[model samples]
Target: MDSRVFRGGRGFAYLEEQDRFLGGTQAPEMSFGFIGCGMMGQEHMRNAQLVGRASLGGVYDPAPKSVDCALEIAARAKGTTKPRVYASLEEACADPSTDALIVATPNFTHLDVMRVATRYNKAIFLEKPIATTVSDALEVCRLAANHTQPVRVGLQYRYKAVYAEAMEEVFGRQSVGRVCSVNMLEHRFPFLDKVGQWNKFNAYTGGTLIEKCCHYFDLMNLFAGGAPEQVFASGSQAVNFRNFAYDNQQADGLDQAQVVVNYDNGVIGGFSLSMFVPGAREELVVCGDAGRLHTVEQAQLGSENQNHLEVWAGESGRSRSSAPTYPSYIAKAGHHGATFYEHLAFVEDLVSGKATGPSLADAFWSVVVGAAAQTSIDKRTAIDIADVLPVTDDIQDLMLCGAGL
Candidate 1:
């Protein structure tokens, strides 16, 4: 194999029969201890290899199948040792070989996991929907605030090419002018089977809004530029999982929802979600006084996603539409390539000893909005942000602008 063309830097590589760079410059910089080895946890392992900065130091999960699968992936890397199969979460956190921790446990377990992970004081890459409830998320933030190590939450949707470009157009270039409204839509199949069927119940998954739609709500908060003031939502366990039961427990996860968030900045954000659709599609629309920006990503049952972004300059400027994409290799890593960039950022921040991307505050507000929406559905009324978060003097800085920090 040609070393020049396929070097081990941003990804795995092939080595020449007799080469000097074989084990010299291609070593992974940091090793990550995985607290969960399920679907998203395995994805992080793949992306860490793709970024070529982090190696899987070890993994801890109750399910042997998950740990085996994660180890299978880790074994494919170029210059990393065989990762340890940790006996427990505490063992993973206490291992001296791992430089950081990736907490990808289920939504409900985040708080408990954070409690132990924080005690280790290792840098953490926490998965999205920090917790199942607003109060739990607030506590997670509080734990992070006291920890000395930097914490980067996994709000990876912000890194997708189409959405990233939209952010640039709306925030960087002001291409969309003064944003007045934002709309987001996601149509997809039902949730896949998990190890324990924990996701089939609202008690565990934190309802559909907090479990799945938190990503969209987070984007809405970012685009709308403030904390949501009020949320009115309607949803039900319309179709998916309605007839399903595991271990004699009935499934009650919501399969459809319509949410409208009124931001303190006077921007209205709307979201439409359907988990019973055939394939997958997500679209975002931002309208400003000057123009409008729209981006969409769609995929067939077994095909790759197609992403496109468009900006209309109204009457006074130019209009353009283009496909925003990362390298095919990177995109294949996970989450349409967003997770790869998220790992890259995580590694960079570790090297610089600086925190970037979504902070704990960002994750807290994202959950607050989703929790508020779920409560709105539960009560059949509009829910206020203050009611959801219960802002106190300690957290006052987080809600100061009612928006992305």
Candidate 2:
């Protein structure tokens, strides 16, 4: 090996003898702890263990069953070591072995969990929708801004191969032609019942728009390349448990919602979400001035499976266009499972002392957009993003939004 390229950590001196010299050596693996062992948490745990890049320090979930389930899965995948289970967030964060923490708790709990995690100087990987309200989300961002450790939000779509290529093709190549209009439709199985008891209450999840469509909203903003000067959106509990309750049926009332956001620029975006789709992919389309892009319906083979992207561009009047082929980036086999690619990217940043993408500041904006959408649904009117997140120089002022002390 070249002496110039090889390096070692402090306290260890490399003694390079002959090329054939044999000695036992190993690199330290990253250790990770998971908070909130819910569905997403379990998925991440499986991925991290399978990736073999990080060892599971322990997992914390208030529910005993969840903690047991997480430990079982971790032991089966890796092996039972001295992993500890805690029923509290403080226990998880205070663990000396924990190098990173994954927050997969309810929307409302994100800020509290993040606040505690930051105090312990742990790198954080928070799940989507950052928080239930804009202010709380902004506080999390503000706290993260002061920390030197890496903080990453779960916008996994950004890590997907097809999605990345599509972005490059649309924005990078400018095939989209300024993106004057965007239409997004996502229909998945109803999460109301899927989330179990949590589905009946919007206080915890922030309804369909904040909890679910927030992803689409973030993606739309990315495609637009900037914040919307204004937004007008209208949504309702048109179908599902809410409507069923009115009809005298015992339902969980978490069914469907549609929202339309109009940007200050000419671009218009529409979102359709429901748990009623029989087959997934129901529809995901992005229309631009120059061309249109679509994902294959029912493209998801598994959580780790990559979806296919089809692009139609090169104008031939309004109706004629050529279809282009794109490869998928989903990994077929890995310990980290589907999320390893993104999670490892986050871990690498933490270990290397580098900044992670989608900074908490940017994620705060996503929460602002989500909260605005929720307000629009409540007031039955279009809400401006600024109204939810008024600009201010002081971080605390931004969080309080000029509210009286």
Worst 10 residues of 1 by lDDT: 1-10
The Cα RMSD in angstroms, rounded to one decimal, for candidate 2 relative to the true structure is: 7.5
Candidate 2, poorest ten consecutive residues by summed lDDT: 321-330
List, residue by residue over 89-176, the lDDT tens digit for candidate 2. 8889988887889888887788888888888877788998788777677677777767657778887655555556667777777665
| Over 4 Å off, model 2 | 1-28, 78-82, 192-196, 243-254, 297-306, 315-338, 390-392, 395-405
Cα distance off (Å), candidate 2, residue 73: 1.3
Could you give candidate 1's per-residue lDDT for residues 1-405 as a string of tens digits?
Answer: 322235545554354535645443556888899989999999999998777778788899999899989989988865568999888888998998888999999998999999999898689889988999887887888788788788889999999999989988989999988889999999998899998988898899888899888889989998998768999999998889878999899998999999999999999999999998888999999999999999999997888789999999978478999999988888888889999889988999999976568778878878888899999999999998888775677568555632333
Could you give the C-alpha RMSD of every candidate to the true structure, in order shown? 2.9, 7.5
TM-score of each: 0.94, 0.79
Candidate 2 accuracy as TM-score: 0.79
- Model 1 spans > 4 angstroms off: 1-5, 8-25, 400-405
lDDT score, candidate 1, position 303: 83
How many steric overlaps are in each model, in order? Answer: 4, 10
